[model samples]
Target: MPPKAEYIELKKSIDTLIEEVATVKEQQKTIMALVEQLDQTQADNLEKDKKIAILENRVADLEQYTRINDVIITGLSIKPRSYARAVTPENGGEPAELDVTSTERQVAAFMQSKDIQLDCNNIEACLPLPKRGTNGKPSVVLRFVNRKHKIALLKQGRKLKGTNVYMNDHLTKRNADIARKARELRREKKIQQAWTANCKVFIKLNGTPENTKVLVIRNIEELNEYDV
Candidate 1:
């Protein structure tokens, strides 16, 4: 071959080799960044799992206490007791107590201690006083305090059937409902991950939307021969 043509061919080969090396370096940087992002995501997911577990256990404990309270009041046939004191000292009135049981008294005291203002206006009407079900089972009724602050109250709670208390079905049902909500939250997180991954790939590929660099590379063979 002629010396001039031979020299030109060698220069072309050198240029191709340089391009290949630059492409490889770019790919390596992209991969390293992806790995770091994945590690951070995994750590965040672990924290979320811990938080969910704590919330689940707390809800279960609350459900158990609520169901048991219903049983106590129902079996005892205790009416909800209330107290009233006269402001006028000259009248010398007595502190009126109702035919409520020990369990009812404890629950009312607990509610008052929590600063949950009770709507005692229709207390008698809202009964079998928040503890009795017409079908003769205990129920956890959601009642409102001061026109707000909705709370769970028990009714018709009798201990029967080998240490099991007959309460309304909603008690166990609430736990299942909460689990469904958690599943939806996890699904949203998956979508967010996909969106983030796309964003990262776009940033690394860096080109105008009209001429993205990743799209310009047609095949693995072209990428290997690319000029950096």
Candidate 2:
């Protein structure tokens, strides 16, 4: 081959090799940058996953508590009950007598254990007044079922031993009170148009002590005959 021609061919081959090396280096740099970005994204996602797990656990606990507690009413009074005790009490304390038609001590015990309270704010009608017949003498006649039990305990009375009982806005009261007030405002048809304060039920778990929500009813009969 001629020297000039051979030299030209060699120069062309060297230029092609140099261009290939440059292209390889550029590709390597791009790959490294993508790898770093992927690592950062994975770390961010992992952190978000951890936070999501914590939130889910909190939600689960709250849902569990709200499911077990409820409120209901019958006649002119209110009662509360919890399903925590079920049909048995294995504790050493005096066994609670189960009542099928009334809210018994079992409801009280369950509320105490769970730190739940029941308020009668949902009862709207006034206490039944004694009636007089044509004889102008007071006649003793029971007007409501379980009237004797309700009167003796005065569970329907609004005069309670509360610090801010008359206060229009009191949030520190028991959860039941808050719910009852909410219900009252709801029954009066003053939910959205009215300026009703936030009446919410706060719940605390046994050990974790977290606040949650519960629904308020008029009496235990709402759950069952003896749920109060």
Top model by lDDT, which number? Answer: 1
**Clash totals for all models, in order?**
4, 7
Candidate 2 residue-wise lDDT at 35 = 99
Q: Against the unseen true structure, what C-alpha lDDT does each candidate score?
A: 0.42, 0.40
Cα RMSDs of all predictions? 21.8, 19.8
lDDT of 1: 0.42
Writing each residue's lDDT as its tens digit, candidate 2 over 28-96 gives 999999999999999999999989977864664464334222222222222433333334446556455
> In candidate 2, how many Å is residue 89 off?
39
Model 2, position 126, has a per-residue lDDT of 21
Alpha-carbon lDDT of model 2:
0.40
Instruction: State every prediction's TM-score relative to the real structure.
Output: 0.35, 0.32
